[model samples]
Target: MKIARYEHNGFPHVGIVNHGKVNSLPDGTDVLETLNLPLDAQYRLQASAGRHHRVPLEDVRFLPPIEPRAMRDFVAFEAHITGMKKAEPGDGSVPEAWYEAPAFLFMNPWSLTAPGADIPMPPLTKALDYEVEVAAIVGTAARDVTPEQAREHIVGYAIFNDWSARDIQGREMQVGLGPSKGKDFANTLGPWITTPDELEKFRLADGRLDLEMSVTINGVQTGSDRLSNLSWTFEELVSHASRDAWVGAGDVLATGTCASGSLAELWGRAGRQDPPPLTVGDVISITVQGLGTLTNRISPQTSTGVPVPPAWSRRQPKESP
Candidate 1:
């Protein structure tokens, strides 16, 4: 089942996607509320379907499937990690600790945007890029869950674009801390969420998804890979994320970039300059099998009042002779 949140006639509505059309529920109903319900209750609600007002899919404006209460993005692809390490001036070996467990970083939930929304090019960055990924939405509160129990807590999945500013991110990593401003500007989620029941058929015996994920820039295919390539399964990622912490309904957890899913990785492997970083008017589309495509265009940067300094102004501090 595909669940969606959309705007029609200046009001937001939650609905189910069927036959290329949207069957919107009564006004003021929140989609997150449904996600918070128990799995059996949710199934019952689906079984007792109501006659909702239907609308043509093209008419409604898409919103992020839900306003996430919190977000965590994990780096779970070995090839992607190797590529990233090689792109920087460092030993390109995957960290040994990564094999032991999944590593993740908290992302700003407020940065969420909808499908078809124009993502503003962050003025502070000259190396803007996109990370094609899949996000699992939490269905219920979980604490200290095991990998075997994680899937039960996941309500659905959605396509995620973890927009990045490489230059800023590199500088911060040099200080031994994870990203901050570079990733906080924009992170998109939508088209809609595909329920777990709809994806069960594609799950492998080991629990990894067999979904195909791809990325396109302005209609040109740049990269493609299978979700099965992930070093850690979504269940493991969720389990690791919930270790000693409570993950509540509406929290979003994204699998990091797939192999060759971002420009940095592509350029690092080919030993060539990155295709021009995203600029105003460039459309980026990311699609995952079972989950739908999410498309966003780059928009002109808005003035933040603080000007980016010239290169000379970034010189190291002078020492006493």
Candidate 2:
């Protein structure tokens, strides 16, 4: 089942998409209330529930499908890792343990915007970049989950754009923080969350997760890759995150970006040229196979200049009276 949140007449809401119309629901934003509902259940509820209504597809705005109880974005794509290594060889690919260890970095929830919304260019940031990623939403709680049981916990998948500030990220990593500053600002997620049952109907030609994807900037394709190339599986990531942590419903887990989804394309193989970064009004679109496209516009942040000190400071401490 496809679960969605949309906005109409400036008020946000939850809905189900069927035959091109968005049927609105009158419930709190509790995703579990209707997420992953089978088509039969959905139809039954629409007919029986007086709170349900439908809106024309062209009139509503889409929001991220799930309000995750917790968000954990993992770096499981090898191509992104290797590309970053080649882009900045000094950085080097993560240690082998990282493959087995399955690490994740936290992203700012305040930065989240809808699929078609305009994203703001951060103040004083010139090295703005995008990463294409896939994320899974958990449907049930699982601690110390095994790979075989991981699939049951997954509710669905969606496309994510991990907008980054490379300069701030590099500085923070040196302090062993792992993307506290560089990774904040903007994280785009939307289109819709595809339930596990829907995904089960499709598989890569090689029977893997290698889905075709691309990232375009200003109507130009900048990078492209496949999900099949991931170094680790989604199960491994789930297992890793589940250890000592309570995996609960609405938890979002991001599978890292693939090879071509790095900033090196705009930068260089070694060191990039001076200040190859995003300016206001740049549009970025991240597309994943089956999942719809997530498009966002980058605009300059509104600034009010630096503030001046109070008159008391200008007058000095008055001889420490």
Candidate 3:
């Protein structure tokens, strides 16, 4: 089943795509809450799926499936690491004790947008970039999970775009503070969470995820790669992530970007000069097999701070409360 979080009539909703229509699920606090039915359980529910209302996919806006109690992104893809190593000096894709500990980013849980939305191009960056990744959504609650037992926690997978700012990231890393601001601006997700049972049909074909992956700027295809290129498996990510932390329903673990990032290695493969970074009106679309395409348009930034309307500025309380 293709599960999605969308907005209709200004209200956010959880839904499943049936045929080509989106069928609303029962109202719940988060994606997992509304659609936590497991594959077998969900199949049973379909016989009596309650409160469902179909809506056109275009009329509603999408949102990241989970309103996670906590969220982190992992670098589980080797191609991304190799690419970063060459793009910047001293950058090693083989993380220290990575196999043992796993590398992850503690990102802002609130900084996510849904599919078919407009992302504010950060004012601080002219070097805006994109990272195409595949991620897993955790289903059940568990702590200190073992690698062998990790698959039990996984619910499904989705495509992720870790939008980035190279310059801010470069400056922030100097402080060893993690990829805070550079990463917090926006992370695009959705197009639906495809479950494990549904995923089994895809086989690894020729060392690549049988799924076709590609990116388009506006309407032009720019980069492409396969899911088979992932360095680490989702099971490993789940085990490592749950080492000390509790992974609950709706938690998402992202497979880091693959070889085709907007910040591509011009000197390495193509030998073409690196293109200038993205600008306003640039639309980035990432398509993965099974999972559908996620498209977002770049819009100019307003202010560097959290978005606030002029009417909401807390003025001096009319010279005294």
Candidate 4:
């Protein structure tokens, strides 16, 4: 089953997509409130959505399916890791620590860009890139769940894009901290969400989903990889996330960039960038086999606020390169 949030006739709604048409949930259904519902209850809601109005899917403008309570992105693909390592000035070997456990970074949950919206470039970044991923939507609240238990907590998956600023990210990593200003600007999830049952058929012999994931920029294919390439499954990532912490409904746990899923990965593979980085007016479209395509155009920079004086007496920070 596929569920989407869209705007039709100048009004926003959440609905189920079936047979190239959208069947809205009962009128006045609160989106965030529905996230707390049990998986069975949500399925029942989808089953009853047909009782409401139905219309062509193309007639509606898509939005991010959910405004998550928290957003955590994990590095789950070895190919992406190796590709990233290759770009560094070394033997291009995978870190030994990576095999021990999954690594993740928390991102701004408030910075969601809907499919088809203009993605504004953050100020001071010229090397804009996109990370195509499969994001798992948490269904139920659980603390310290095992991988199997975490699997049960997953309600659905959506196509996720972690829009990045490579220039800023490189500098941030130099400081021994995870990405900060470089990552919080924008992260997109959309096209729609698909339940795990609908995707079980795509599982490979290794028990990983074999869904094809691809990305294109300005009408040209940039890279593609199968979801089966993910080394750490969503359940493992979610379970690790729940260790001593609570993972509730509406939280998003994303499979980080797939093999060559981002332009940064492509740069790693080729030693140097030939096509250069994204600029104004560039359009990025990402597709996950079962989920749909999410496209966003690059717009000018966005300003959260003007610079403010430092709160500390003598902790002046150096200027960003």
Query: How many pairs collide in each candidate, listed in order?
Result: 0, 3, 2, 0
State the lDDT at 268 in candidate 3: 36
lDDT of 2 by residue, 1-321 (tens): 556788888888877666677777676745665664665776675564325568876778887666665778888876577657655546565567766677787666666778888777765556888889888877788899987688677767889888888876766677757886577767878777766656665565443575788988888887888877776667767877898888887778888776678575435454663325667888888898877688888876865424446456555656565
RMSD vs true structure, all candidates: 3.2, 5.1, 6.9, 3.7
TM-score of each: 0.91, 0.84, 0.84, 0.90
> Number of the top candidate by TM-score?
1
- Lowest summed lDDT window (length 10), candidate 4: 305-314
lDDT tens digits, residue span 1-321, model 1? 678999888888888877877887666767877766666876766654335667888888998889978999999888898887777775778778888888999999999988989999897788889999999998888899999899888888999999999888878788899998788888999899888888999999988999999999999999999999988888888898999999878899999999989987887876665676788999999989998889999999885838556455437765559
Q: After superposition, how far is residue 206 of candidate 3 from its true place, in Å?
A: 14
- The regions of model 3 sitting more than 4 angstroms off are 27-30, 47-52, 90-101, 203-210, 264-273, 305-321
Tens-place lDDT per residue, model 3, 45-121, is 44443366788777777776666666678876666666566655554455567666568887777887878888888
Single out the weakest 10-residue window by summed lDDT for candidate 3. 264-273
- Angstrom error at residue 36, model 1: 4.7
lDDT tens readout by residue for model 4, 1-321? 688888988898888888899899876776656655666887788788857689897888988898888989999899899999988777999989999999999989989988889988788787899999999898878799998888888878899999999988998888888998888889999788888888989987666888999999999999999998899777888899999999877899999999978999888888887467999999999988989888999998777635557356456766669
Predicted structure 2, TM vs. truth: 0.84
